[model samples]
Target: EFIIESRDIVGNQRVIGDDAFVVEVEGPSKPQVSVQDRDDGTYLVSYNVQRTGTYHVRVSLDGHQIAGSPFTAQFHPGLVMAVRCTGVGRGLTRAYAGENARFTIESRDTHRNKTTSGKKPFVVTIRGILQVQVHALEGDNGEFHYSYRTPRAGVYFVGVLLDGVDIGGSPFKLTVDPGPAHANGCSASGAGITGGYTMVETFFTIYSRDYYGNQRTTGGDVFSVEIGGTASADMRMRDNENGTYSVAYTPMIGGDYFISVMMDGVHIQGSPFNIASDPMPRESYLEMYRSMEPTFKEKMEKMLLGGDVTGVKDRKKANSRRGKEAAQQKSWVLNIKLLDANRLIPKDTTVDGTYGTGLVQSSDPYVVFTMGSESVRSTTVLKDLNPTWNEEMKLPVENRLEKLKVEVMDEDLQDEDDSMGTAQVSLTDLVIGVPKMVTVKLKELNEV
Candidate 1:
């Protein structure tokens, strides 16, 4: 059933009279139905189309005429579009009269190149704050169909508008070169070594080139070199004979460096050859030389101070306190990791080896101590079965006391135990003056 409402009068609706409509079908016609009523001086109506195929329906009431409904058995075809250019892609924007910028529109998706689906009767939407002018193309397929132009030099948004709604904002970039002021030749050079340090310098030769590569050898404006790194000052040059000019620099140190040349303050590629330091003398000490050069030493201190290799091979000799006897008496907590068999004895104990007498055992009851003493030591263990002994020990300073010797047998007793393990012991010196502690540990590699 179909119903109709009046747009001129609010809340006014009507049902057509039963005899007021005439319906016809292309093929065989079927029975139709209509309902009609009159209330409060307003008419009301409802009707239904029974048969399919092309049909015509006319509605009239009270001597009033209405438009007939002509129905065709077909689907709705929406909108389509095309775009064209008045000129080639080279100067699309140059064709502008007043503020109209020009551009070439290409299908964003390459797959749509052969598409004729929506080529005509479609809408175009340009997005951007700037005003844009476009011309609709007439043909279905062409390399560049649409011609778009812009008003000025700024970012512009362009896209397709369908059914009064925008599709996507595709971007286009426009660049305009103002052309060279004059021809400027790109040139460079380096600083000379005075004393032991080298310097850097640079210059330029202005040469103008046209869009066709024609050189303008005369009347090119002079540009300056931009200062960077250790360069203390900035300098520029004036055009000399022909187009060559000069600039200079004194490098802070010896080595490879870059001297950037510039125009006004804008950078132009003018980095020249390496600025080198005076050759270092053959027999000079590296440490002395670096120290004399404040900048060099400041850079390499972390590399030079890394290890403690001051010619003293023995640890005891290294930690010896020669001048003050009271300070020499200071005690350090040392971790003496003994051979597993040796842990039974107290750590830092002195161990003297009698090679011919064979292995030493924990039962030797040796005194444990630091590198400086013989008489001062910690409590000792009596045997291996009673393993693990600990004590704070003191060392003597009169002799070169590097190794914390573990004495297995006293010279007077002449008795040595044979159960010592086969692991060799390694001694590492601790840093001096840093109140440090040492722990002696033991691990048995080949279990006994």
Candidate 2:
């Protein structure tokens, strides 16, 4: 049996037997509806309405109009401005007659509204009489473009049409200059270290411009920089954290090194500067651990409270019990690895120096850990000093530590004492190379 089922209106919600839903509308005037009928009876239909006007969208049942809405189609007017006939060839006053010219269209409309089929149609027109063919853009944001050719080399007017109406008469000009031309320029600025280059790391300031004296820094184009040949990388001038780019390069030679800066893949021609790197002093690291020795012994004493042997050899028996308890409470351990080959290091006796490969020979010898793209906190959790290499390092969060970095620095000698140097290192001071990075993704511990 066929039922009207409360009637259906175009663009309105429709609920079918229990849970299914559908929206129905009358087809547009120019194109008929593209509908597909299911064996169960629901029809999947689609169509497009070309121009702006009030039209009826009818829902039908066996060729009879059951329900409908008066759908209104309107156009929105907005502005699209562009410089016409931009030169494209290597040399130019203007490009050749048939050559393809490139130009940028600056479209501005704070209110983002559809332009083609609203209540009011958007009107468009251009000056120059240059004979051109134009077409509407098919993308989401309403766009229209045109192509033209110089017929007899005289001035011309380009006109725009919208909803069969012409827009404001004045048009953008395209001066066809005869040519043999070229263009070029450069950029430069002062660069100095701020903060401690070793402990705090630093940034450099640079002011740059282009060949035509155009401020390239404001152009938002990215700039690439490479420090010492081995430690090379690229960065955008605009992406600098504070009007400066930060890169860390360890100068093995300890002298002035030249830095190369390139913009838009083309070297800025004359933007190279000499950066001085002082020699890194001898260094050593010390890590301490909070052993659970006493806590374990106290727990053993509590267990013996209920049981008693009247004369259980007081001193010797108590000592053995305390030792057993201390062993059981040892859960977390901390360790520090002393790395020094190029320089000598005095042992912390608590930390074992594993004479491993790159031990002291490489500047980046410390164990570094990172989360995705961000640095995580690192802390010393255990220390063991034996001829054997055995120690443990804890995660920073475990100790309620605010920072994740630890470094050893000594100026007078190759090794520094535990109390002589600083313990907390801020992650911000370290600039990691391009390929190496850390990123952290924390799942919400509990949903509010």
Top-lDDT structure, candidate number: 1
Measured against the true structure, the TM-scores of the candidates, in listed sequence, are 0.19, 0.22
Residue 151, model 2: lDDT of: 29
Write candidate 2's Cα lDDT for 331-388 as tens digits: 3122323221122133333221321112221111123333223332222322211111
Per-residue lDDT for 1-448 in model 1, tens only? 3543332234444333323333332323443545433433333444333332344444444455445444433212222222221123533323321233444343322222223334323354444445565676555432234556543333234554434533333222233222343223343322221122332232223333322233323345556554444334344455532323444444445455444555545544333333434433322223232223445543333334334543332422322332123233445344443221222332223342421223433354433343544445344445343333434454444432245544332222444433333222223322232122222332332111
How many Å off is the CA of 95 in candidate 1?
19
Model 2: lDDT to the true structure: 0.34
In candidate 2, where is summed lDDT lowest over 10 consecutive residues? 283-292
Q: Specify the highest-TM-score model's number.
A: 2
List candidate 2 stretches off by more than 4 Å.
1-248, 263-266, 279-400, 403-448
